[model samples]
Target chain A: MRNMLLLAQFEVKKMLFNPRGVIALAAFSLVWLLILLYPIRGASEFLISPDYKALIEGLFGPEVVSELFKWSVAELAIYWIAALYLFPLFSIFIAADQFSSDKARGTFRFLTLRASRESIFFGRFIGHMTIQTILVSLTVLATIVLAVSREATLLMPAIGSGALVIVNLVIVLLPYTALMAILSLYANSARQATIYAILIWAAMSITIAIINNYLPIISELKWILPGSQISLMINTQGLGSFAYAPVALLQTLVLLLLGRIYIKRSAI
Target chain B: MRLIECKDLSKSYGSKQALKQVDLTLDAGAPIALVGPNGAGKTTLFSLLCGYITPTTGEVSLLGHKPGDAALLGRVASLPQDATLDPNFDILTQLILFGTLQGFSKKEAKSEALRVLSLVDLAGSASQKPKSLSHGMAKRVAIAQSLIGSPEIVLLDEPTAGLDPANAKKIRELVRELSSKTTFIISSHNLDELEKLCGQVLYLELGQLTQSVSMDDSQQSQYLTLTMQQCDSEKLLNGVMELADISSIEKKQHNEFLIKHNSEEDYAIESALFTLFKQNSWQYKAILKGRTLEDKLFS
Candidate 1:
């Protein structure tokens, strides 16, 4: 247990200290600030153009105009999309290189002194999750600050929804992170694991769309893909409705289990 | 009791066998040199011993515990070949992190990190990241990391590979100083370096243990290269060969001979040869030197 904690702590420190991680976080925050303060003047104009507004209302209902008006600092924050996709991308970049790079650098043998495979795997997983939480929190706080400063009459109708959104986002992202971790353990090189992960995700996405289009018998397979589930969760909640948390939880658990099994059986 | 023992261990990757029915025993308090040419299973053996990879067949035990059995790791520390440190971290932080993982308290990790870094002569680079240091400094940092928690078994693979002559000398001296307290299995391509620090040598060739030798068992001799005068040199050679305690002789050139004699009895052989030269009224020149370990290794 102590060894696991130490491994996790080191993982966290690595992410925090890495210049690429720091720069990405900084860049995301800057973009969040721009989106929050100038949504109508800038971003919302592009998303809420006459044609888009028609499409929005046609899809969501006429009240989406008011929904657009109720966009809080949190709503303008990109973390919702960022956490769903961008955060997972960063998680891949941070972790896909974890074990393979260690092997490449010849450190995996040395690291075996500190802990066993089980501890190293779970410990790094916890550390990466911690980093994700911290990055998400920072982006959320920055968005709230920008919202409060720009909009003085802030009752923030979607504040509760925004919090739920982030929670669901994390839940959806966990499985993908676990899968990437397993890929990292199995691959001999970071590039190979990353390419494998991206290709898998792409194939799953295309398969989900194709299944959704024609297959009545296995159309439910679409929900198994985390990306499809996440899109459903986002579209459902974005229009002021709650998603099925149990389904999301179940998918997350399966991915985590698969990841653990892969890591346990992996050679390195 | 043996601190480590391996029995018919074998490992293969697909079709390439890395280790083949290898057997070895490491006794307490003895530093063993694991010497081999490139791709001769040195790293593979270390990996199996350290529990980074499981053997395809056979068994390895560390102090009576199986390798990779969590209980065995507390006493067994390994410095793998070319192990990389996290380049983003300072040496102190890197050490502290590893120490803490090995079950040291935060305060203990800090102090031990400082002490080990200094032991490796890397005190000045404590605040520097690994990327900023030279290859030799980074290697020392890796060595420093393995010394944490005073592990009983230290497995160092090519520890001195990239070091400069001075740094390599320092590391060799440190290994000699530390040998009394810890058992080391160090692998190197440099036979001279291993000869300087190891009491026992294990030579691996083609994934098999070909030879094992004890440094103490090889006797040192006083060797001489002599030039003989032309008084029928065969009679002179024949006369020299007839002396007692002369170990061997080799003809190096038309008129020169290389001679070896037990050091304690060298004087007797030299005196008898000198007497023969005077009686025969022959002329000769001789220069003597101490025998080296390399000569024995090849011999």
Candidate 2:
């Protein structure tokens, strides 16, 4: 267990210390700033205005207005809306090279000399998850800060919901990270791994839709893709958001198991 | 103690069989040499021993544990041919990580990394990334990583392949210094180097273990090379043959002869050869016991 943690710690160091990793982090920070400036910061006042209530009713219908009003802090609401989809997409890129480049460079041969392939695989998986967790925490903390700066009394409430938001967002990104673990095993590069993820996602959706069209009984097969729970997950608020956690957990479990099996049989 | 055991070990890539069914047992000892021509399955066998790839058939046991088993984590280390360290991290960081993984604390790992880097004469380059180092330097760093924790069994594939003469000699000296405590299985094409470093040789040909020889065994070390001053080759061979206990004689050059004899004493053959040289008025240049490793393996 100690060895596995050391491997995980080194994996994090590898991603952060590499020039490419620093560049990726810089790009993410730039995009995040743009998000904070335009949609999140710009729309903050509008979320509390009467006009905003009407716009929500017009766009999402009157029924959603009541459900949306539960979110008193505008920054947290907007952050959640943006983060639900943004994080999982960014995760694919962040985790895509978990194994591919290392395997290609033959570094695993050095690592596996002291660690097992299983430990290295899961150690890297844990490392990617830890990185995603930090990114999520930073963005969430930013949202919470923005919320409290505008209305000091919203501090306690924002902190309460921000913690919940972090947990749910991490759960949603788990399968995406795990999916990369599986793709990285076969991909020769991170770019190739991302391409494989996109191809597999599109193919999976198309194949399921085509199959479901002829056989309606198999409509539930849509859950096989990692993103199947995102749509449902985005609609829930507060404690209700925990409902789809099982689906994401199941997907992560299955994908990680598949990755482990494939890695065990693979040549380093 | 038996250090390595292989039973019906075989490996194939699709339709091409890289290693056929072969059984081998290696005991704990000084360094052993794994020698073969290209496409002779030397790397494949090394990979199996290191547990980088599973064998298609049979089993491999290293230090009483299956290759790649967690039990053998700190016990067995290997320098796989062409395998490299991560280019992103500096040499010390990677080496320290390897040490910590093998159960060293951070402080201990750092010191161990430094020790091994010094062993390869790259302790000063510990802070430099792999890309900054030349190929030979990077290769030595890779070798240094394998030496971390002073493993009981170290398998090096082509340890001196890219090294210059000075660096190669240093590595040979390092192996000699460490051989008393660590068992090394070095696979290389340099016969002369192996002949100096190894006590046993595992010779493979076309995926088969054709011969497993001791460097000091009678058949390999019993012959002598006689270099005489310019003389008639037939006359030189005839005079050498006239000596008793002469098993065979081959005229290697116009004035050189390789004589294989069944004599129990090397001095007895030398004394007789000295008399034969005087009878033919051939002044001797040099007499060397045993043939070159190249001659032993190929000739």
Candidate 3:
């Protein structure tokens, strides 16, 4: 327990001190600011015109705006969809350097002195999770504040959406974190791990889309992907639904198990 | 009791074996020097002792416990060859973190960190980040971190690699002072410094232990350079040779004769040689000589 705490403190210190972490937070804030400043006013018009409303209504049901609003805030469906790409990219960027950076800087030796390999691995994972959770939570809070301030009528809807977005983001981040931790342990270089992470993210995204269109039998496989599960949860207007909760939970467990195994078996 | 013991330890990276069937033992209170060239397996040996890397086919024990075991880790401190501090953290923070890992509570870690930073002469730079410090200062901070919990055994790998002479002298003095209560295994290419600090030495060559010698044996040679009248040279040399204690004599030049004595009998032989010079009415200019550990180590 002491070793784990020490290592976690060190990991947090590493992240806080990294210049890229500051940059990432700044980038996220800027994106949130832009979204709040410019609302997607013509989004419905471009995607579904009044003529197609009848067709859209048949598929989506009569209360389209109410359903859209509920889905948007209840599950943070739109934001979760966007985070599919954003969260994985963030995970790859934040965690790709966990082990490789330490190895490159020669800090692994220093870390090993205080803690065992197991403590180091799990400590770093927990620290990254904490940082991710805090960042996403802050972003949600900021967006809600901005949206409510812009129009009082959007307050409850914004608050609801923000809460769901945070939950979905946490779910989406878990597998990416696990995958990146594994990459950090397995890869010799940070660049190689990063490249591989990005490639895998892209491949998985494309594969999910293809499977969703062509193979109905294995379409459920899409829900197993880290970002896809969150996207489904967000679009379904059910934050506590079994469709999203059980699958995300299971995926998280599997990724974490595999990550721990890889780290334990690794050479350094 | 032995502070460290390794029996027929071996380790390999892929097809390249870094450490062969090596056996070593370190006692509780003696400071040992590990001297070796690059790739001589010095770091590998330290790693094995620290449990950073497991041995492929042997057993290593620290304080009678297996290496890397929780008990061993709690009692052992190591200053790795290329170990780096977190660039983002200040010196004090790093020290405190390492101390906590070594079983100190937060308050205890803070106080111990302060004490260790002072030992390494890094107390003033406690707030500076590692990236802001010079290479030597950073190395000193790393050393400070290892001394945190005051473990029973401290393994320092090239502890003075980047320090200037003055800093190196300070570190050597600190090690000397600490060795009374702490067992130290210091690895370095600096023979003279090692000689000054270590009571025992382990020399490695090509991943093998070539020699292990005690400092007492290394200090046995007594070579004296006597500057006297050219006429008295022959008489002095004869007097030195006649003494049973004199092992060998080498004539370096017209006036200088290198004298060797058996063990610590140099004082007796020197007194005799002076008596002979006094009887012969020899006029000597000056006599300058001392024991050189480097000579023993290299030769």
Better of 1 and 3 by TM-score: 3
Task: Give the per-residue lDDT of model 3 (tens digit) for B132-206.
Answer: 989998889888877877777899999998899999999998898888878889999998788788888998877
> What is the TM-score of each candidate's chain B when compared with the real chain B?
0.82, 0.92, 0.83
Q: Name the candidate, 2 or 3, with the larger DockQ value.
A: 2
Residue ranges of candidate 3 with Cα displaced over 4 Å? A13-20, A39-77, A150-161, A188-190, A202-225, A228-231, A240-242, B217-239, B250-266, B275-299
**Model 2 Cα lDDT, one tens digit per residue, A64-108:** 546556786778778888998899899989999998988888888
Task: Write the residue-wise lDDT of candidate 1 on B87-126 in tens digits.
Answer: 6677798788777878889999999999989988998889
Per-prediction DockQ, in order? Answer: 0.59, 0.82, 0.52
| Candidate models: Cα lDDT each | 0.73, 0.88, 0.73
Top-down TM-score ranking: 2, 3, 1
lDDT score of residue A78 within candidate 3: 40
Q: Which has the greatest TM-score?
A: 2
| Best model per lDDT | 2
Q: Write the per-residue lDDT of candidate 3 for residues A5-61, one digit (tens) a residue.
A: 667766776666668667767887787656534443223233334565456567877
**Candidate 1, residue A196: CA error in Å?**
2.2
Residue A92 miss distance in model 3 (angstroms): 2.0
Order of candidate numbers by DockQ, starting with the best: 2, 1, 3
Q: What is the total number of backbone clashes in candidate 1? A: 0
